[model samples]
Target: MNRKQPIFYLCSDALGDTAEMVVKATMQQFAVDEVNIKRYHYIQTEEEIYALILDAQENGGIVAYTLVEPNLREVMKRSAIEHDVQAIDIIGPLMQAYIDTFNDSPKEMPGLQYELDAKYYNRIEAIDFAVKYDDGKNIGGLLAADIVLVGVSRTSKTPLSIYLAHKGIKVANLPLIPGIAPPSEIFTLQNTLIVGLTMDPNHLLKVRTERLKVIGLPNTTSYTEYEPVKSELNYGNMIMKQLMCPVINVSNKSIEEAAVEILGLMNKK
Candidate 1:
């Protein structure tokens, strides 16, 4: 473990995704690669809170927690104070602010944000739309798309499309195969935001080779070769140029990171 890396301890009485989201988004403010995230979910007992605080003391790390029950929340606060560790109550302060502002009380419910609301159902519909149109399969209904992503193989088109879909964006991803022209309607659609995703040829080759290996196929195909990957990238770039869409590189970036840029580009257009 790198000592320069900060150990972030996340605790919650429910699944710790919200706490983790807080930590990860805060960590992005800094330009660092080494962050050790330790998640302690379903933490209901005072004993569990104490034990985690002890671990945080031992590591000299910070704690980020979301505890709804007052007793359990106090236990975490006291334990962190006793252990002399920096503890961040991810939900408490905001919950208090909200309660005071609205003159209401905390419901003390754990994981209430995970309820299947209208937004969740919208994401489900978008996911289904992306799956139905993946790999340029259903080009006829692409006129209904909110965003169209075009890229050669392994440029993260599918994952990016799905991630955007989860945010209620109707996304369609088309694979850029050499010698095949893109859908004619894509050029005609004026309202849809068309994006061209690209990746480093070497990285694409490695990704394709690993994918082939996972599917029990040999890596000897042109799909996994450096020269062929480079040619594909060039051809894909030519097509993107013909479409006059914004090009984004996905190499060495996470889905969220690329989505941020994609959304930014979409907003500009």
Candidate 2:
């Protein structure tokens, strides 16, 4: 299409996650910066398709769409034909394949992947709570969390907390920085809710080095060195022993796996 920089047009009736995902995955097969994206959401009228088609033709762009509404999808097809524009129906091909093979049809409703129930809202609330209390922020309201995680840097605390939040468990993570006292709630919270997270020193060094690189910071500091990381791990273990709470080792485990262990401990107490 566009000789200078190809344009990728994504159209959808709801949020364009599917079409965007298709575009992104396809782009990964080539170069990362080869194309520029133009997203069009909630295509409700034929006039919108006509206007978008005109722009695609002018830019020599390809339109990839996931319009589940039958009438709107037809309008998009007709407009692309009238404008001599290249169009890709991202969902239609897959849907047709399912229909042909299984002799089944979809209800063609938008946003069927989303839930709006009490559990769903609770997850949203937990995610908010996790974000609010991440890294010991907003710990003045310690009773709000279902679980409190303490860990040195690069122990997968934040990610594990988020995974638990998605399962409707409110989680708070406190950083175990040397010379910095964590929230006093760590001492007062019941052993059930207060747990320590640790990781192998070598893995912690690698993780912290990569983290520093990502933020454009130097790794010359003691944060990523083996000895300092080992010292931090030892300190965390001592605190865990003193508090007599569960200690979860997150080395070589996924966020989901770590959450499962944390949840099991929470259930026990």
Candidate 3:
């Protein structure tokens, strides 16, 4: 006879995403594979809780639940004990802790974090705007953008733009290639913050060299050579001087650090 896989019953009055996330995170600590997870969402009545407890008892499964209503939680606990089922309260202890520590009560609402509000819609719109105007694809975005990034290649422009968009700031980036004039719209911006990104020549050469290797291009290509890299940086610096925007040296900074600097500038503006 083969051993059956252990099942986990996730019960909730709402979408049950919170219990599912906790279950997934706990599974990472275990070595076992092929554990079954069954989700029961929008569970409201005592009869529904009894049915789920019966199912768990039959399958020798453990129940993990995020029940907000005291009546539903009491029924789940009583039935689980009566049927000899192991039940874990995912959020009940945390709620109690908050009440004990701060003497405050939760609203006992489910899926409040997932509510679609103005900030959520703004983030979605900003992310869409980032994708639509990425890499200088649409010059028109320059005028409407909250911040504009101008840099040579491999300065983390695209990732930075997406990160900023997550914070609900619309960002557009343009690559400052040597001898390629940027769009005329870049010069007319009055309200947008134009940020210049530059990297050390040696760091850029190493980065571009690795990039070429990953893409199966020759290391001898001008894109990775010292002279061409220096020329690109110099040209980028000249453009930044013309625009008189704040420049960020990304040679030793992380995306988060650079973002903090940019966000500070935005706050000051």
Q: What is the TM-score of each candidate against the true structure?
A: 0.75, 0.66, 0.66
Candidate 1 lDDT over residue span 235-269, tens digit each: 99999999999999888899999999999988888
Question: How do the residues 149-261 of candidate 2 rate in per-residue lDDT, one tens digit apiece?
Answer: 88888788888888888989888888888777666666777533887898989888888888898999977998877887898889888877877778888888888788888
Global lDDT of each model? 0.89, 0.83, 0.91
Stretches of candidate 1 above 4 Å error? 1-11, 20-64, 79-88, 94-108, 214-216
Model 3, residue 123: displacement in angstroms? 1.2
Which candidate model has the greater TM-score, 1 or 3?
1
User: For this target, which candidate reaches the highest TM-score against the unseen true structure?
Assistant: 1
Worst 10 residues of 3 by lDDT: 1-10
How does residue 129 of candidate 3 score in lDDT? 96
Off by over 4 Å in 2: 1-3, 78-86, 92-120, 136-148, 163-167, 177-203, 206-221, 237-269
1-269 in candidate 3: lDDT tens per residue? 12778788999998888888898889889877866899999898899999999999889888999998888899999999999999999999999998999999788777776689999999999999999999999878898899999999998899999999999999999999988999988988999999999999999988888888899887777888898889999999999999999999998788989999999999999
**Native-to-model Cα distance after best TM-score fit, residue 48 in candidate 2, in Å:** 1.5
- Candidate order, TM-score descending: 1, 3, 2
